[model samples]
Target: MARSISDTGSVVRAVRVWPVAGQPAGLPDSLPEPIAAVAVPPAGPSWPEHRTRFAVEVVGDGASGWHAPVSEAVARLVVDTLADGVVGHDAAAPRKLAYRPRASRHHQGAHARQAVSAVELACWDLASRVSGRTVPELLGGTVRAHVPVYASALGLDPAHPEAVKVAAWISEQGFWGQKWPLTKELLRQGPVAVARVLGNLREAAGEGRFMVDGLRRCRLDEALGLLPVLADLRVAFAEELLEPGGVAWARVRAAGAGVPMAAGEHAVDEHEQTRLLTGGAVDVWQTDPGWSGGLARSLHTVEVAADLGMPTFPHGDRLWAALALAGACCRDKVPAVEWHLTLEPLRQRVFTDPGAVEAGMLPSGPGIGLAPTPVITSPLPVWTVGS
Candidate 1:
């Protein structure tokens, strides 16, 4: 049972990680203004059909949640790392707690970063609960009641004809914009094939803005070369055309990909962002609080972007990042947030009321206000932390 939310000292007592079914009970009729068929992309290495998250129920006292677009397991062994850093700490000190894992000498590789991010999200949830506020409200009340959202069609394999149809259908609906992923196969087909798809999507999009996620589908020069074609297609931005921290980013600006270029979704600190932006490699900054070392780091990244006049846009299809960025976007920290059509109602199911959107904007609430409900597709997989 969940303990009462208290203002006094509350410490994380136990942590639970569980897998929830990815498919929604039913597609929500509300979002995208006029509902249309948005194809769910077949599961890929980046996004699978299952949802896994961490929940921290205050042991001695407070609250918490999980994020990431992947379901890589949180090792039972790492509980020690998390315990040493967070188990007994006050829930209110989220930044301090979120950094504890990194502060420890044991941090290693991407898995460690993902582990820390999970705990950090819980900390923010705990902090919000203790303060009787939503994370956004605590960050400072939002700038807009609802942040503008773009439909993320990462689930669709863009090279397929289904993608074109789905793109046309959803574009007819009201959304701030639409983003499609570039698969390895599509990129292998080279610029000619790429142009055809973008052109078709642009026509299908009507007036809706179109964007592309390179997903590292092609070489930097090749990605840059497509700029003129993308410009004609009116693409809003091209994301991750090259590797996140690859040497090629420094040379990207000189190549002048006519359309806007975006990177940094995998970047965790201002230092990383600075090196990427310093060279003018790309025009936009993509930061995901969940992926970029959690809320504190994300805020710091936004401030860093402001210093460089770079627009902040958090990238991902997960709820933790979605809600976190949504709060920040409402506060005007980010111009817009990405809402993966794949996660859709399934992601919202994890929340307590999960709220609703009006005119492409999500309603604000307390503590991110999400709780895991039973997923009917399969038996729930649960992980106990600090056991």
Candidate 2:
């Protein structure tokens, strides 16, 4: 007789969150100042100097699953409220395990939501390991063997003399495209300056292969003014141009802006994502699994986007999850994933495999492939909860 799904599934036995000290290998001693810092003050400590990092692990009867590079606060939030519900539950059913915490608190906020998402991701990783399958395969067999990725130039300053050189290097590296931030400071420099910088970047990155992130710092008029320049440059897309929850304004902008509009990285739940999709807010969806309630919710958003004739280009924070979704979905629906050029090298240092890109594509690896490296030397977990 063949075993059923339940027979093979593992129950969650314990959950642990560890705080690792010191920076991982491959991170530069100093990083370029972020473009957003010019317009908006940073909310927390700088990444280079921030010595502590968190990783979550879910231990089960069959195997252990892991997800790293979350905040200490988010890891603590998991142990405090969400871990009790997760303990002793079926690890294979991550969505079901996530429901109690999501439904119980009306105001779990982004940190709490991220905690739930981390646990949910761990559960899926555990389930995939127990079943001897990759997370993408477990989700539904992969549609593509490799996922294309674009270089997201987060820390690279467009005003720097080497900006064009960096853009050309990224192009030479075979990235699908390069995205540069459009901070309000840059916008205030007037459209002439904006056009010149973007024009030079486009020429360096290759025509039709450059994208812009407005960083949600621009006013309606500023964003509208940018549309013509973006369209004339034949930019790939403009992301988060207006303030959050300005879907109506985004829709209006999309109607007239020849460049495609993208958002939803800040949408915390399915309801918010649904509103964005239904309101015709954007031509492209850019949900992040790590921050947007995990892979299950992100996948659902991808499906909804597909049904509505929109494409999803998942945010790059959690590269493994983004790669999993891109691998599982039709190429047309999820054509590419974002690669944070500056941050990913540091992020990848925690993983054993690093999931390196070749020819601008990441090969589908096994089980979300987030096994932590020896660099995570913390002997004691900050928090642990078990059945």
Candidate 3:
């Protein structure tokens, strides 16, 4: 019965992984330094942007999976990896497959982790579909059915004076928290200008939980100088105030900023998550399963944070997975899921039956255990066309 149930768990019967082609032929021979070199190319109605598809389906048995999750085209690399890997594995035992052994033993880098996240998400979706329960119920049960959200904006137009437009839109959606990235260029404009930006953001968001994500920039002294103004503005929490590292982290922690600090997205492994937690460097432990290995690793990170009595606010992406785990395990400390306000919603929309992200919580259901939405748009092309 267990085997039968596991076998028929996922709605998807089988899947295939295919690499879709980008417009411009081969990517740069050598990746540019400061690897943010891979900027996004524009796509419009005429040119449909394509992502590598792991043509996933639930099959009778003997299925397979592979990698090369990176793409010069799209950033949602995890979707394909998980779709490919989790296709045949008992969606019931997804956590085991997530930590499955590899021959060469690649490190838990972004690609590998993204793969795990995709599979875990799919498994949860399958479980929810099979069981007819929301993912939150599968995990445990929600403390609150709808989670309050904070609008995240590391991708918003910096020069656009109407930057507040997005925040206001989020406010309109009933989100109370709103965050914007702090660029070095903006910071160099000095505290006055920074204050002006903050004032603008607050005016746009009203009495919401406004936040600043520094994106791991700034030195200790620089952060120290900025802390007072941030605290005075009654900012909720200063995220990634200093570049993550032992010395710099220690310096920022020692600065005694009246305001709380949030960090830990850079933690690439379970051990690093533990070190950061033990070091007392971060007030909010933000784990990204797409970077911190996979669901198991992320769960371990959350466990560590929970042990220390801190909240685990995942650093965006794979939010459904994070919220599912949060519901199952650490409820109290899971303050809010970092809703990447601009990007993730589009991915959800592409799904035929995307998971219900109402209020904030990803609804719990059955099978792999979250809402069943066909997140994949289409299968990636196997052969290059018109070349």
Candidate 4:
């Protein structure tokens, strides 16, 4: 069955993009900057010192306003191309509208696709609000209310013992799964050391499943060499073993290694996403709605992978990014979303209770379900396009 959004009779009136910073309004108020810096693992993406995030707000002539955070590259496009492109366009079929940019842009890099992604999501969010429904409802409803999550983080320096603590904390925090980088360990101690660390992590994680993020630092031979250990510890997937679109994908897929390989955190548009998923290059698809050209295309990628029975685990570095996908992910199909325990406090700074993980499920609320703190909203600017 082909999917196309039918125009529902609403027109986009305006779009606004801005940078924001704030403290979490949810329970357990915002942490002090110094404390937050200490709280998050050193290698995580978002840091307290650099808590600022880009946001895209969309308004409709008939529908209420909606907004979501944009990362990588959305500001320029919002003020230039996308703002003009979306105004006066039909608002009902967001994914269809998203196709133009996906095809038109030649060298669409991180920022370009991020703006497009933000626009697509703004349309869907506004439409969902207009229809008095949730984003997931528009996407055909979800399989469950609460989404299962995996604790995702990075290990400290090679000599540091924080990997054990990070793994232990993730396990005790109730996440059903865990993913941590082997950057320093692998560089300092080599594959054998990483294998031992993983074994220790498996012990620390107890019943939780384990996943490894190579951060594009693991070589083909290194990752291949670790397969036996991966199997021994029952590791689920090895992410970003080498640069995306490299021969490594086919090699691993053909190696009969039995270890599922994952990538796509850097996919900028549909074409790259297609190349990654269409040929069975990777077994597990790891995309970021914020970076993969937006929520619309990200979901499309998820659908494509789902058809092939490949699980979709959208990156969880950005809390808002995860919130946007909650309604679309199914427990049986998608399985888990990534969450960084150390960054939760900083994540809360942008929105109250960004998305709560309880008993291993992420239950979403209505209409973006997040409110910006005053630090990020004061003197807010809203851009409008005329009829």
Whole-model lDDT, model 4: 0.63
Per-residue C-alpha lDDT of model 2 across residues 1-387, encoded as one tens digit per residue:
996645765677888887755444443434433322221223223654245678888888757778777777777777777777777778777656755543245445687668777887777788878877788887788788788889888656786666877777778878888899886668899778899987888888764388899888777777777778999888778888876567546554655857888888988776788898887777888898888888888999999899998989999878888888788898888989998766676667666666567888886554443333324667787788884
Top-TM-score candidate index: 2
The number of clashing residue pairs in each candidate reads 5, 0, 36, 7
Question: Across residues 140-174, which tens digit of lDDT does each residue of candidate 4 receive?
Answer: 67555567777665423322354566566667767
| Candidate 1 structure quality by residue, lDDT tens digits, 294-342 | 6776777777676787777777544445555556553445767777775
Worst 10 residues of 3 by lDDT: 31-40
Q: What's the lDDT for candidate 3?
A: 0.56
Candidates by lDDT, descending order: 2, 4, 1, 3
Candidate 4 positional error at 94, Å: 1.9
lDDT of 3 by residue, 41-120 (tens): 22321243434333222332332222222242222343333334433455545556655433335546655555445445
Local distance difference test, per candidate? Answer: 0.61, 0.75, 0.56, 0.63
| Candidate 2: stretches off by over 4 Å | 1-9, 22-51, 100-104, 251-255, 366-375
Candidate 2 clash pair list: none
For residue 192, model 1's alpha carbon misses the true position, in angstroms, by 3.0
In model 2, the Cα lDDT at residue 20 comes to 59
Candidate 1 differs from the real structure by a C-alpha RMSD in angstroms, to one decimal, of 5.0
Shift in Å, residue 43, candidate 3: 11
TM-score of each model, paired residue for residue:
0.79, 0.89, 0.73, 0.82
